[model samples]
Target chain A: MTPAVAFQKTSRHFGAVRAVDAVDLEIKPGEFFAMLGPSGSGKTTCLRLIAGFEQPTSGSISIFGERAEGVPPYRRNVNTVFQDYALFPHLNVLDNVAYGLMVKGVGKDERHRAAEDALKLVQLPGYGGRKPSQLSGGQRQRVALARALVNKPKVLLLDEPLGALDLKLRESMQEELKQLQKALGITFVFVTHDQGEALSMADRVAVFNDGRIMQVGAPEEIYQRPASRFVADFVGSSNVLPPDFVQRYAGQHRWGSLRPEQIRVRSDTSGDGVAARVVSRHYLGAATKLSLDANGLRLHATLPSGTAVPEDGAHVMLTFNRDQLHLMEEQA
Target chain B: MRSDRSQSAPTGLKIAAAAGLAFLHLPILLIFVYAFTTEEKSYQWPPPGFTTQWFAVTWGRADVWQALGLSVQVAAISTGIALVLGTLCAAAVSQTRFFGREAISLLVILPIALPGIITGIALRSAFSLAEIPFSFWTIVLGHATFCVVVVYNNAVARFRRTSGSLIEASMDLGADGFQTFRHVILPNIGTALLAGGMLAFALSFDEVIVTTFTAGQQQTLPIWMLEELVRPRQRPVTNVVAMVVVLATLLPILAAYYLTREGDQIAGAGK
Candidate 1:
């Protein structure tokens, strides 16, 4: 099948700044894809390019086999749920959701019914009569989602849709959004800077940095086997052991990544492990994070909550499972 | 602590505020009082006596009626032109960027910023040079020059405050340009436009300096009132007309104030 969205060597430049540079991406139909990066990493720009809000400076973009570069957003069969809900304040919830159908010349009664159904899909039933101003942030977010979903576009682009919500609400919304995408079976292109959000929610994730895609793969692959130093450092905060460190520890001269949780720390200075001094300790409720110095090479290790944490400035035995040290390709 | 500080202003500041209010409103109160004065020729202490006959006299004057009609017509047409031109200008300046965009915005606001007499003299000379006859349209053109600024000021502020994502969301939801404008942009800026139009009407209705230069054969109410003030047949009659002018201008200004009082509450603001 043709990809739901494809970019051929896309590059969006603003004067001297390369907002999105030489990007070649293809998102499959019905896939929950995420473009993950820090701010200004071109993730949002790529989403906008798919939505036709921003045309590539030098590229050809296609949406489901249709040329999309010059196509206006209104003509594209893709809708966006903006970061700011962007609900029309003047319109009540029903009208805001029904707006797409109304503009498409759907009959008022039919559009109303469809809007009510869309509202129900977002679990906001009976909120039709209230204006957007009257709703809470989460409710408004749902209304925005309903507004976009009511259009029934083949692809949906969400720009950091959960950034403003509280942690609890954001977690719940993530689950709801994942379920919604599965039920609707529409291609979802989610942009976010939060790696946990990306890993937990996306089927396939693209890690972006400096206007370039560092790596793209399944969530487990991104977490377990990052392709580069940037991905390893950005995705899961893994302890990136240098080539020298790897050569000394694992008998190889390749850069390797060891997840913090995979590193075991024992308070006793015992045999069969590298001795390290605990520089600092932090209690994180579920785990204790320790900054360790193993002969001047700094590393981090997370000990689960039940594990006895050593006193600060104490020497400890640190051991890493041989299989857990994943090698990366890039030198930098 | 905050409520105590807010509720109890210093006594000196209170007196000063009362005095300032009195200073501003005493002149207006005098205008209202003199409208009912019996004296028809000259100023007097305590207005000599009060009467309602001047209102009837002012009502019967054909010149007053003609001037009122001209003023209303000019104000209405000017406000209509300002609403369209000013809104378009505001949209262009606020929504998009181009070379000299700031210069164009400054140019749009220049007429209202410059001294009125300078604008009046410049308009008079431009009209004569262009050989455009001074007619009802000339007065409207002159009024619209400044009236556009009023509408532009309000509309541009509102346009800046309104989130651009609303327009993007509209388009994302399958709305074309016009539909996005009508459904999203217009509703967000509607009150600002109405308030601007109201203020434009109020400004155009009582415009005197520009009208004096532009209205060669026409007499807008203010010009009529100006002439009546200089050479009076029944002085109280002019004050009665002044009272009407005050009310005419006051109602719309008040309405504009109330309409824009909650301007910060535009949807999606701070979202």
Candidate 2:
């Protein structure tokens, strides 16, 4: 089947600022695709262009295989859950959810039934009667979700849908939203500035920077094999070895990225590996992540809770297979 | 406001405020006092006797009834015209910007900023220059000039406070431009428009100077009051008319204040 959403060399400019410079990508149907970046990275702009909130100054976007050029957002098949939810203040939740159906001239009885079904899908079955102001942030987000999902568009765009929630609530909603997507089987194009959010929830992520896609792949592929220093620096926290390491064995060191768990903490007694000392240790519940000074380089090692941890001054050997190490070419 | 002044109001200031309150209501109080006073035979502080008969006579006056009807007519027509023109102008100016948005804004504010006499004279001259016969319609036109400012003021201010995101949300959900305007923009602005309409009605009802200049043969309440004040036949009835005008204008303002007191929340990202 054709992809749920596609952007073809899309470029959008605002005066002197290039909000979304020439970008090309695809979001597969039923895939939770995330556009991850920091603020001013043009991720939201890309989502808006796909949702038809804005037209590309150049290139084109298509939803479900059809060109969406010059199509106003109202005429488009996709729906958006805006950052602030944007619920109608004058209306109750039922009215807000039913708004799309009402505008489409769906009869009262059928629209109400659909709104209730949507509300139940978001687990807010009785919340249809309450105004948005009466609900908490999480509830409001769920309402925004139900409102969008009710339209049954080919793609559902979420622009920082959980950015407004508390950290705990945000984490919980990430799983909830992921589960919701799986159950509904609708394409989700989620835009978020939070790297953790993109990683934890999305099936595939397109990491963006300065109006360009730096890398795009499955979560593990992008995390384990960042294409550049920017991607490695953006995703999972990784320590950069000296420039000489990437320059000297540039091809052999093609293992461009490493997870903290992958590094084997070998004993210093009989080791040929580069030597490092423990600098700091944080004992998280299940594991301990140790920050180390490996000679002149900074490295991170996450050890299982039962592993023998070295003291601050104790010498230790670190052994890692070639696959654990990643070589990233410098981007100009 | 000065740093030298005490943070709490002094005793002297409190007494002065009490006196100011009394002073503002003093004339209105005297109107009712003189309405029942037998000293109505002559303008005097102390009336010889109090009689409630003038209230009955004032109620029965044909001229007062005619003026009341005319005032209602003028107020209705003026407010009706203002609601459409001011709403359209507010809607037009609020949305689009051409060459002179600021200049148009200044023009909307101009009529209310000038003294009523200037506006009255300008309308009279414009009518004469154009050779349009002065009638009830001319008075309606004159009242509408300033009335537009009242409605436009409320409507535009409320429109600015409404979230642009709500409209965008409506559109993104499948409503077209007109439907979004009707379902989202219109409901959001309904209170403001209602408030503006009330204010325009109040302003147009008691408008004297402009009505005087514009009403050639027809008589509105304000013009009739001016005539009664000059001729001096039924002074007590003038007090009754004043009371009616006070209630007519005050109720809507109070209602508007009550209506906009709630829904003061700020939501949406791109407001």
DockQ top scorer = 1
RMSD to the true structure for each prediction, in A, is 3.5, 5.1
Query: All candidates' TM-scores?
Result: 0.93, 0.85
Residue A1 CA displacement from its true place in model 2, Å: 2.6
Best by TM-score: 1
Candidate 1, residues A1-332, lDDT tens digits: the string is: 89999999999998899999999999999999999999999999999999988999998999999998789999999999999999987899999999999999999999999999999999999999999989999999999999999989999999999999999999999999999999999999999999999999999999999899999999999999988889999998989889998887778899999999999998778688888999999999999999999998889999999978899999999998898899898863
Over 4 Å off in model 1, which ranges?
Answer: A267-273, B1-20, B46-52, B98-103, B129-133, B264-271
Q: Write the per-residue lDDT of candidate 1 for residues B118-200, one digit (tens) a residue.
A: 98899999999999998888899999998899888889999898888888888888899999888888888999988888878
Tens-digit lDDT track of model 2 for A84-196? 89999899999999999999999999999999999999999988889888999999999999999999988999999998999999988999999989988999999998888
- Report the Cα interface RMSD of each model, rounded to 1 decimal: 0.7, 0.7
